[model samples]
Target: MIREPDGSIKIYVRDNRHPQVIERQLRNLDVRADVTFLPPGKDCREPRGTYLPDNPALLTSEPPAEGKDDYWRLHPEQIKPGQTFVYTMWYEEHGDNRMFTARYRVATGPVAPCEVVPGGPVMKEGPEGGIGD
Candidate 1:
């Protein structure tokens, strides 16, 4: 997690391998979160719009019935290989509050590295709190 100078935090997941899919389980994340996506080998990061059709079906606290585990499902809508998935979170406390943390583990699909950077805010479209964020 990257602590910003303005007291915000930036969490990112980077895919550096062949084309693959990534899923993140959000057990906490009680505060406001802005999810952004960055293209492969590019610095431009844009907000990933809502995952419709499956938006309501996706679980943010518990896994799906067919899910192997019980955790919220968060993934990039169109993240290809070498792309970066970033989720920036902001809290009212503005300090070291560990309550808004998300955990990442090895799944059966692919393996990617996570990084933290300086960022803030995000754009939104469609419904509110899309993807259960």
Candidate 2:
């Protein structure tokens, strides 16, 4: 986790383990986030909370090119009161390769616990390497 001079927060999750610790860290940063790491074939049900319209300016995957850290840059100020960020991550292994996947969601008001269920088929093409890829 890195806090920028402009008040934006950048997070890079190199290890998906210990999600509860991650949630606690984000909370300490004054960011309301619910982090969940699903098992190999599991996923969270949709509509876990009130959905917020997609806004790249508020939360984006693209990182600044010059930085060595490829973090998810977030403008927390853009997140209104009563809003919480939800992150779900999981990975699949094929032969010697592991494919990591992450999904981000925003919820307003009360956010419900993630309802575990079997996830859909893996994408034909996922990020080839780590997040920096």
Candidate 3:
């Protein structure tokens, strides 16, 4: 999650991957969000926390809002569109267990443009410096 100058958060993906089950679970848990952003490659990052202030994570860091913090939700204004953010893969698998889950940590940075692969339709390409095809 990249923090904007205004303190709003912007998650980036060339395009959106909507209607995923994770999103459904978030809704069930009362998390209000629009879409999921993906980096060019499957690997990407997740923000561990934000820096609004010494305690930007808590709304109370600024002003008192009863017992709850206004920033407690960590929801920022609008995520600047077209920015590309990604994840870093952390795989865990026991010697005997072939199954494993991959975790990611968000890295703050910018993603240059990219091009589509040749095997896919439209016969497109990505920016020379962009990650993944």
Best model per lDDT: 2
Residue 1: error of model 3 in Å?
23
lDDT scores in order: 0.29, 0.74, 0.29
lDDT of 1 by residue, 13-57 (tens): 222111122222221322212242332222222223322232332
- True lDDT of residue 61, candidate 3: 20
Best by TM-score: 2
lDDT of 3 at 66: 75
Q: After superposition, how far is residue 29 of candidate 3 from its true place, in Å?
A: 2.3
In candidate 3 the C-alpha lDDT for residue 3 amounts to 45
For candidate 3, give the lDDT of residue 96.
27
Residues 16-101 of candidate 3 have per-residue lDDT tens digits of 23425434533444433333333323332223333112322322123435773222123332222332122221222234222212
**Residue lDDT tens for model 2, 1-133:** 7788999877774545678887887788888988888866677887788878876687777654684644677688877778898888775555555566677777898888889989833533346633221
TM-score of structure candidate 1: 0.20
Q: Give candidate 1's error at residue 28 in angstroms.
A: 20
Give the runs in model 3 whose Cα sits over 4 Å from its true position.
1-19, 33-89, 97-133
TM-score of 3: 0.21
